[model samples]
Target chain A: MPDDQLSRVFAALADPTRRDIVGRLAVGDATVGQLAAPYDVTVQAVSKHLRVLEDAGLVSRTRDAQRRPCHLEAEVFDLMTKWIERYQRQAEERYQRLDAVLARLQDDEQQQTDPDEGAAS
Target chain B: MPDDQLSRVFAALADPTRRDIVGRLAVGDATVGQLAAPYDVTVQAVSKHLRVLEDAGLVSRTRDAQRRPCHLEAEVFDLMTKWIERYQRQAEERYQRLDAVLARLQDDEQQQTDPDEGAAS
Candidate 1:
C-alpha cells in the first residue's frame, strides 16, 4: 500500500471508537444503527467514524440502499501488518545484537574475576 | 498495552515522516540531528516528531545531554501487532466460514444438476 493510504489506515484506527467499531465488524457485518447501539454517541457520530474507516479502505459498505451494512476489509490489514512487521523484526534483531554484545562483555568480566579469585585463594 | 497508548502509537505512526524516522531508528539509534538530515524539515521539526513517538512509547531518548540518541522500543510493536492480529484473524475466519457456506451451496447445486443429467442420459 502507498504511504498515504497507510497513514490513513493508522489515523483511522487511532480513535478508540473507530477501533471498537472495527472490532465489532470483525465478528460480522452490521448496519450503522446496530453498530451505534452500544455507544452513547449519536448515529451521525458513528457514521463519521465509518467514513474515516471507509476512506482508509479498512471498511466498505454494500450497495443496498435500505440497509448498507459495513463490511470489514481484512486485506488492508495485510498492508499494515507487513509494514509493522518489517520494522518490528529490524528492531528485534538490533536488540538481539546488543544482547549478544552485553553477554560477551559479561563473560569477559567473569573470566577476569575467575583469575583474580585464583590469585587471592 | 492500554488503549490510550495504542491510540498514541497509531497516531504517532500516521505521519509518513514519523514512520520513516521509526524505520531508520529500528536499524540503529540516531540523534535528532542525524534523523533530520535526510528530510528537508528542520531539526526542531524532527524533535517534535520524536516527541510524539516518545509519548507513544515507540521511541526513547537517552539521558546524554549532548547526544540523546533515539532508541526504538520494540515491545510497543507487540501491542500493535497483537491488536492487528486479533482483528485480522477474526476477519479471515469469517471469510473462511463464508467460503464454506458458498462451497456447500455449490455442492448442492451440482448434486441437483447430476440427477437431471442422469435422467437425460
Candidate 2:
C-alpha cells in the first residue's frame, strides 16, 4: 500500500476486526489460529488483517513450530497519541486566542479597557 | 468514493497536503485560495482535497461573497479521538492483564505454587 506510517496506522485501525485483533494481542500473544477463533472469518482473512497490523508496526510475529504468534508493540501507541495531543492542543490554543480577540473587540465597542491586542493576557 | 466514514476520513487524511490544510483550518478559517497558496499544487487539486475533507466532515464552507471560508468542525476531532482512545485503552488494559498472567506464571515456576491458570490469586 502506498501510504505514510500515519496513514498505514490509521488505515490498519479503520477496520473494527483489526482493532479487535490488536485488542486480543495486547492481552497476550496468540497464534493466528487462536486469534481467528472468535471471528467467523476465514483464517486467511484474519491473516491479512494481521499483516496490515504488522505493516503498521502495531503487531509483530514470532515463529513457534508452524504457528506465528502475534504480539502487540505498545510503543507505536505513542505515535498516534503524540499526533493527537499536538493538534488538540493547537486547536484549543486557537480557540482561546479567538475568545481573547472577541473580548477585545467587545471592549473596543465599549471604549472601556485599553487592552493590547498583541499582548498575551 | 465507496467508503465508510472511517475509510473516508482516513483516505482524506492520507495525503500530507490535506493534513496540512486541516492543520491550518484548525488554527483559523481560510478561503480555498488561501489554503491553496502555500502549496505548489493547483487550486483545483486543493479544491478537490477540500471536497474530501468536507465529505469527511472535517471542513465546512459557507458563503462570504464569492468566497467560502472553510471552518474546522472541532467535533470531528472527537470522532477520531474516541476511536483512537478506545483501541489505546483496550490495548493498555490487555497489557495489564498480560502482566498479571506472566507474573502468575513466573510465580508458578518459582516457589512450587499451585498456579491455577483459571484462578487469580
Candidate 3:
C-alpha cells in the first residue's frame, strides 16, 4: 500500500476477483450488478472492488441516467507495462552481460590451467 | 491478499521500497547487507522486503556457506506481462469494435435524417 499511482494500480490488481472484473469490463462496460453476478460476492463487495480500480484510475464510473456503468481505462495499463518492461529489459541485459563475463572468465581459466594444451593437441 | 502466484507477485511489488529493491536486484545479485546499505531502513526491514519478494518467487536466496545472496528471478516477470498484455489487447480490440459500431450508427442516422436531402442537393 504505497500512495503512488503505480503502487495503487498494482495493489488494485492483486485481487483475483478484481482482475476478473477488469477482464469482463475489457470485453464491454457493465454495471456493478452485472460485474458482481458471476462472483459469489455481494454487489457491495463488487462495488468495493470497483472503488479500488476507480481510485487507481483503471476504471471510471459514468452516469447513465439512473445506472452508473463501470468503464475500463485501458490506457492505465500502459503505465504498468512500462514499469514492468523497464526492469525486465534491464534484468535481461544484465543477465546477458553476466553470461558474457562468465564465458570470458572460463576461457581465461582454461588458458591459465594449460598454457601448452593447444600446441600439444 | 489473494493466494495465487500472480496475486502474490503484484502484491509483493505494491510497495515502493520493495519495487526499488527488485530493481536493484535485477542489475545483479547481492547479499542482504549489501542490498540494505543504500536504504535508510534497518537491515531487518530490507530482509522483510526480501522475504516478501522471495515468497512471490520473484527472488531467491541461495546459501553460500554462511551468507545467502539474493538473486532476481527474471522469469517471473513474464507472468505479470502476460496478464497485462492479455487484458490490454482485449480492451483495445473492444474499443476498436465500439468505434466501428459508433461510426456505422452515425452514418445510418445521417442517412435516415436526410434521405431526400442528398438527392435534392
Candidate 4:
C-alpha cells in the first residue's frame, strides 16, 4: 500500500467506535443496522464510520441493496502488520547490538581489573 | 495500553512525517533538530510531531540540556500488534471455516452425482 493509504488506514482505525466496528466485522459480516444496534449511536453515525473503513480498504460493503453487509477485508491488515513489524524488528536488532556492546565493555573492564588472573588463565 | 492510548498511537502515526520520524528513531535516537534536518518543515513542526509520539508513549525525549534526543519506546508496538493480530486471526479462522463448509458441500455434491461409484467403493 502507498503511504497515503497507510495513513488513511491508521486514521480510520484511530477512533474507538471504528475499531469496535472492525472487531465485530472480523467475526462475521454485518449490516449497518446490525452494527449500530449495540451502540447508542445512530445508524448514520455508524454509516460514517463504515465509510471511513471502506475508504481505507479495511471494510467492504456488499452491493445487495436490501442487505448491504459490511465484510472485513483482512488483507489490508497485512499492510499495517508489515509496516509495524519492520520498525519493531529494527528497534529489537538495535537493542540486541547495544546489549552485545555493553557485554563487551564489561568483559574489557573485567580483564583490566584482573590482568594477572587473565595472564595466568 | 488503554483504548485511549491506542487511539492516540494510531492517530500519532497517521501522519507520514510522524511515521518517518518513528522509522528514523528506530535506527537510533535523534534530537529534534537532527530529525527535522531532512524535512522541509521547521524544527517546531517536527517537535509537534514528536509531542504526538510522546503522548502516545511511542517516543520519549531525554532531559539532557544539550540535546533532548527522542528515543523509540518499542513496547507500545506490542499493544498495536496484539490488537491487529487478534482481528486478523479471527478473520482468518472465519475464512477457514467457510472453506471447510464449502468443501463439505462439494463432497456432498460429488457423492450425490456418483452414488453408484460410492457404493462400489
**Top model number, TM-score:** 3
lDDT of 3 by residue, B1-121 (tens): 6679999999998899989999998888999999999999999999999999999999999998877899999899899999999999999899899999999999998988797787777
lDDT of 4 by residue, B33-89 (tens): 999999999989999889899999999989778789899999999999999999999
Worst lDDT run of 10 residues, candidate 3 chain B, spans B112-121
Model 1 clashing residue pairs (backbone): none
DockQ score of each predicted structure, in the order shown: 0.62, 0.37, 0.85, 0.58
Q: After superposition, how far is residue B119 of candidate 2 from its true place, in Å?
A: 29
Give the runs in model 4 whose Cα sits over 4 Å from its true position: A1-3, A107-121, B1-3, B106-121
Off by over 4 Å in 1: A1-3, A100-121, B1-3, B104-121
Q: Sum up the clashes in candidate 4.
A: 0
Q: Which candidate, 2 or 4, would have the higher lDDT against the true structure?
A: 4
What would the C-alpha RMSD of candidate 3 be, to one decimal place?
A: 2.7
* TM-scores for all predictions: 0.83, 0.81, 0.93, 0.86
Clashing residue pairs found in predicted model 3: none
Better of 1 and 4 by TM-score: 4
